[model samples]
Target: MQAQPEKKHSSTCDSKEDSNKLESRYQFCGNALRITRDFSNNLGISAIIWESGLVLCRYFEQEKISFSGKKVIELGSGTGIVGILAILLGGDVTLTDQPVVLNQIEFNVTSNIPVSIIQRSKVSDLRWGKNEDQFPTDYDFILGSDIVYSPHDFPSLIKTLQHLSNQNTIIYISSKMRETMGAIDFHEKLLPQHFNSELVHRNEEKEINVYKVTKKAREQPSA
Candidate 1:
């Protein structure tokens, strides 16, 4: 789906008026992930690291989910934190976002992932449903964090999700539940109609939900 050009997300970003380079470090899987947020550009929401991404990483660690040798792809990979972590966990990960944010994400990936393990990760530009055909649907895992804030982008987002997943593909979508952002409706109402969605974890303190999703079986035609 084609989302509006990256613009400022006042409600979600830290309360910093002036645009500048902000660096943050995180520890996961025995690696320190160094991410840089460049607010000087029009990358908007994607420039900053969201809490949903951190929560998802935590879920992976807590559940002991092994991405070893799995083909994984992350959508709307802001700052590329989650995708980078997946790589650290032994997954071959592709990080996708708008063209504007690709450079920053690539930087983060290279900064965090060691040169030996870095080969497992790459960055791409994905306009949701518009160019989903460019990607193969054989991924073992599809990852996303805070990608569902706009209702206008829901149709394309859903279409993209469907295109990238097959019967066995597992999707992990971590989102901050904001009533204004329609996170509840997307997770509770819309996603169920398209896939078998499960609420694997809910962080009440952060108001975030991590859903484990898989494709719905095709209905058989009855005579």
Candidate 2:
């Protein structure tokens, strides 16, 4: 939840040539990523990179988490930073978000990741409640950053998670805890029934937390 300093600039690119945008650089594990975002655009909140995303990336990088040959899908992947890092770590990743933000996700994936590693990644359009058929259900890891804020979207988000995961799938989420309490409520609602949730890391000063979620085991029938 460390506050990010803003960097503004004008850029010409494939998606929207001749537009003003905000650009930022994040570095982790000797790798650096340059991301461009359009906060003033009609894409709304999906255009900005949040502190929780940065904290999650930092934690994974510092811990040397291995994603080698793993299948990973990132939900609400604004700027696609976490998914990009997964690709760098040898994961086959799909970076997904609402359709409007897919262009930005694609741009970041192509511009920042080298051709050698870039082949391991793809960008897909995904809305939380809908499009369940569009994605594969057997992902090894599911990632999300700063996505648990909206109370209205909670049910859809949870349903989407259930649709994507198998019994062995591991879900990672990073969220900023603010006055709204929406993120906290999301965790409380997803308890022993659906997933076993754990608070893996926290930045108390910034009010950010990283959670590791695993699907709960099914009950065995008595003979």
Candidate 1, residues 1-223: lDDT per residue as tens digits? Answer: 1211212221222333434778776676566667788777778888878889988887877666889999999999989989988998999999999999998898788788789788899899999979999999999999999998999999999999999999999999989999898988998899999999887887777788888999999999998
* TM-score for each model: 0.90, 0.87
- Reference-based lDDT, each prediction: 0.85, 0.81
- Stretches of candidate 1 off by over 4 Å are 1-19
Kindly list the per-residue Cα lDDT of model 2 for residues 117-163, writing each as its tens digit.
77799998889888966787899999999988888887788888988
Worst 10 residues of 1 by lDDT: 1-10
